[model samples]
Target: MALKKDLKQKMISEIDGNKNYISVEIELQYQPDLIHLLREEINYIGQRFYYKSKDYKLEMCGIGYLLEARYSHLEHDEIYEYWQNIKEQLNTMVFHEDKHHLKFFGGFQFSEHSLTNEWKDFGMSHFVLPKFMITKENGRCYLTYTDHSHKFDIDNIEEILNIVESKAQARTVSEPKMVANKDIQSEEWKALVTKVVALMNESVALQKVVLARRRKIEFQDNVDVEDALQRSLDSNEASYLLLFESGKSQFISQTPEQLCQIENGKLYTNAIAGTIARTEDESENNILKDELLNDSKNQFEHRYVVDSIIHDIQSFTKQLEYDKKPTILTNKHLYHLYTKIQADLLSENVLEIVNQLHPTPALGGFPKVEAIKFIEHEEFGTRGFYGSPLGYIDLENNGEFIVSIRSMLVKGKTATLYSGCGIVKDSNAISEFEETDLKFKPMLKALGVM
Candidate 1:
């Protein structure tokens, strides 16, 4: 409490005379599990964000909305332009860059146009610069706050400190309960996949389109976001685990696909298609890996992804390179044919490239527009944020986004899990159905349903 008081005094003094810039980071000794704290305590206050990769983690509790830009209807190019405008505004607002601090956190929906009422709150694209944040990186932790206005009140500062102290002291671990699980529209999803594949086989413009399904699970008690996140951390160490809470809806995922990452003037992305189930036996796993690499159907699906991504990014890249042959990337439940692609970025604006590469052949289909239209007409339900890019971008335009696959949206007792598979001419409806089931295993096991 004394340290927090001192920190508050420092901030007050900094902002007392000057109104343009006030940002501070106070080093803390104790490191708390941020997701646990968010779920257990801070969520009641305002919007909360939790992001974790292998080496870095950030948890943000919005003290107040510093700046927010949302659009319900906009073209992709227009959305990118609006975001650039927002970034320009953020650049002028002074914030302390204490190593791993996040200036903003939010995501874009899968589609530019709204599809259903379920994702109305999320809108088509939204990002928020929170007033308070805590970041843990490289075994160190810091508490940070930023305010660019003259209305910096001491009362709000004290409230934030109090909440932090309370959450730090009240840490308790609890187990998540396993409850009933129901697959929504099982037959309809399979039928849709069959229809799309049949069209592809008949020389339709769509060569490969990914189809998704939802599974609804009910828990005996209120679902704990922290508990599910812990399961994700335990099961998938190589994946990016994130949680974003807006009002009653909590979007969370442990995903392995990198939609795009721009850092130090280079662009990085991956082609993660062609999935195969993992086996407990090493020899069996090796055999499955070989089969996936050699299987014509899986290779064809993967080829479309590589080709589409290369074409999409060609305009913005000066020099591009990617692995000629994909390597096997294994998770707890499945393995994927993964190819790494790198390029020299022509512009500092990363969102432009992200807008183009999104819904790649891996997620949408071969011909981007046609595949999306087909999915829109054929799929049973709206894809809220599933298969979309979700991550943060800073004032310097350095950021990373992960494809929101193997994820779920939890509201109270009910949670909806999303999983999808790429469909091509040779794709079997039953096989695609089984592939989706395998894809669901990660989240299902995390939720204690398997």
Candidate 2:
């Protein structure tokens, strides 16, 4: 690992106009232990910094967290302009799926994200907003610094904010909202879901399967990306976040579950299965929570996810400790059975553990291969970034993943969102449909769709 000064120098050199283009990476060691140093750095960066990255040059498997930078315009494409400003600095980009292959219920003209909604939709906080992030996607990636040059004793993140502010124009609106036209009752969806269900039942799938839907919404006339991001931040459905690429805006999230979280050396994963929305009264809410917990079907539904995670994490950890009893967690709108699982990872690094553990019973079905095949071969629509984990992992490697239960991608005024659920023998189409509707609330409110 290089000293902090050396790493800062490397960053400056890479940014300088005079250097020959060569990819460079430097691991800066920490003096105050990895966690404290990282926490201090992230806390600082959270206040400032405009950031961007392509995608991971490093191998990614089950990412504990991922951070994605997105660009969205009002009515036209302007990525080239943004790219021109930082092309030389970027190292990778997130893969863009061809529109022809993707299904559209409400599919729109633009959607760009690094799958963090998969983590956020499930209620896991988006990646830690690392003081520094190694971000990638769309054939581009970069190691962005949140803080540099400890030489100058900066007391606040204002300088970083200034750097971010300088790169982009002020947002055009007070809030960004989603505009989509979707017909869930359409025959097209029926056929697609029917085919997917058959494939899932026949394959080595996880016990549950989540299917998502999306539609595109365009701004009526004038709206900026910043407006959308700010609206997302202020949405009641869920919290909002601004990833890398501080310029153009993309809004993601409203998830209600946590997939995996690593703090210090302890790992916590949640079994978020089953769903029931809250009502007007406390008595009704309590009843709903108890009903969700006591409901045989809901319990049965949740077990599939819990079991799958236990199996996956066990692949790397010798001693997996879990809260023996699952608990009912009530949120603003719904109630869910959330079981917390913890273990000390056996791998030398946390990234490996994430790879082996992702697509748990919650995301994918019981047998991952079959469930994936079912979705790939049978479903007419593509999931896009809806069901994928999106969050950030700092140099210390501690991070979290939300279920991606309620999230969307944005490009310009157009956007697309996705939602899915576990379909067991008992999962009725109508019930599952309702479940997905509840799931959409997070981003729905963010986009003003609801």
Candidate 3:
């Protein structure tokens, strides 16, 4: 074991007094229980973030904040510009090896809208470089400590070492008891969908629009953010798992939709819109999948997504390709029509791609502007970070952004789950309602409320 005094002296020696910022990473031969550590520290730290890739190839746990850029009531492009300016100020260094890069984690709101009390902690756009992060990649783990100044505090280093070496038993988080579950805007959402369908049928230019609803679940005791995250991870292995906690609010998601993933100059995304509930029986599941694929309404919904993605990315992308026919992506309770999209990027400007490709037809609607207008005018509540682009971006501009769907917002003893369905000319009000209901089951089960 490396002595705490030796490590601290080494880190102090590496600090350059002239530089305004520094990042120090130490690779650990044995992996630490990051989730357990996060649970132990988040309360005192006040802000935390976590992410797990769909393939389980990458996982990160971030604590506190070394630097952060957050904005409210800013348009997508404006937020991008601000974030770029902030990135210009960062100067980082890594020890042992230069294999890993520092990353900023957070997300944008669904749109420029009023912030509900539940979502105020998360602004219109927010990203942070954590003071300390445990990154796990390909079975190896590394602990990174970052700060704004080159000066090192010996006491701080000693504290970090003690916490890392502690053999404390894992804290217990009993399953919380549910006191109440209420669906928000049930009748109003149905009415809004009916109106949107009528408008889509009336106008040739207006093809589709998606409407979302919220469900509030209250617990008898304050919910354990880490426990809920673990249950969600246990149940959802094929989706992107995310957590962003600030102050009293925590936003969590197990979303299957990839907004965009940029790696080695290659871009990857997905077109997921059409959906159907999965059944217990194998034959019945096959029938449901077939029904979803062959159904003209679902096909139209899926086609709109595919066409819109190609249209959005064509100007800045080349060699773009996707399946001509949609396939089934099965989740714990549902199946969605899925198409994988890949392209060669003309520029590695990730936020630019995010600005252009966000609110895909799957989450918003076809004819992006018109669909968003309909949602803004008709939707019952503000979306906050739900249905938004949420993920991490590294210094090299290579990272993944997943659509924040099948997600929830937690404050104290209450958790508010959000779900939505695309509405087109053929969409039935009752059917769309049922689809959203099926979408809520994953978070519900993860919370042990079902």
lDDT by residue (tens digit), candidate 2, 1-450? 223564455445444333222222322121111112222333332222221111112211111112222323111122222223333332321122211110000011112222243222322212222233333334433333332233222222233323322333333343443344664433565555565556547864445555555555555543343344445445543322322122233445556555566667777777877778788899878878888878887788788778878887876776787776679866667777888888886653444555566566666666766666655654445454455554434334455544445666565565566677777644566667677677666655656555
Task: Evaluate residue 301 in candidate 2 and report its C-alpha lDDT on the 0 to 100 scale.
Answer: 70
lDDT of 1 by residue, 388-426 (tens): 888877656788888999899888888899999988888
Using lDDT as the measure, name the better of candidate 1 and candidate 3: 3
Per-residue error at 244 for model 1, in Å? 1.3
Deviating ranges (above 4 Å) for candidate 2:
1-180, 184-186, 192-207, 222-225, 235-251
Q: Supply the TM-score for candidate 1.
A: 0.89
Clashes of each: 0, 70, 0
RMSD from true fold, candidate 2: 13.0
lDDT of 3 by residue, 363-433 (tens): 99988999898888878888988999998788777978999999999888999999999988988999999
**lDDT of each candidate versus the true structure:** 0.75, 0.47, 0.82
**Residue 369 miss distance in model 2 (angstroms):** 1.9
lDDT of 1: 0.75
Q: Candidate 1 vs candidate 2: which has greater TM-score?
A: 1
User: Residue 121 in candidate 2 has what lDDT?
Assistant: 30
Identify the leading candidate in terms of lDDT. Answer: 3
Q: Model 1: which ten-residue window has the lowest total lDDT?
A: 88-97
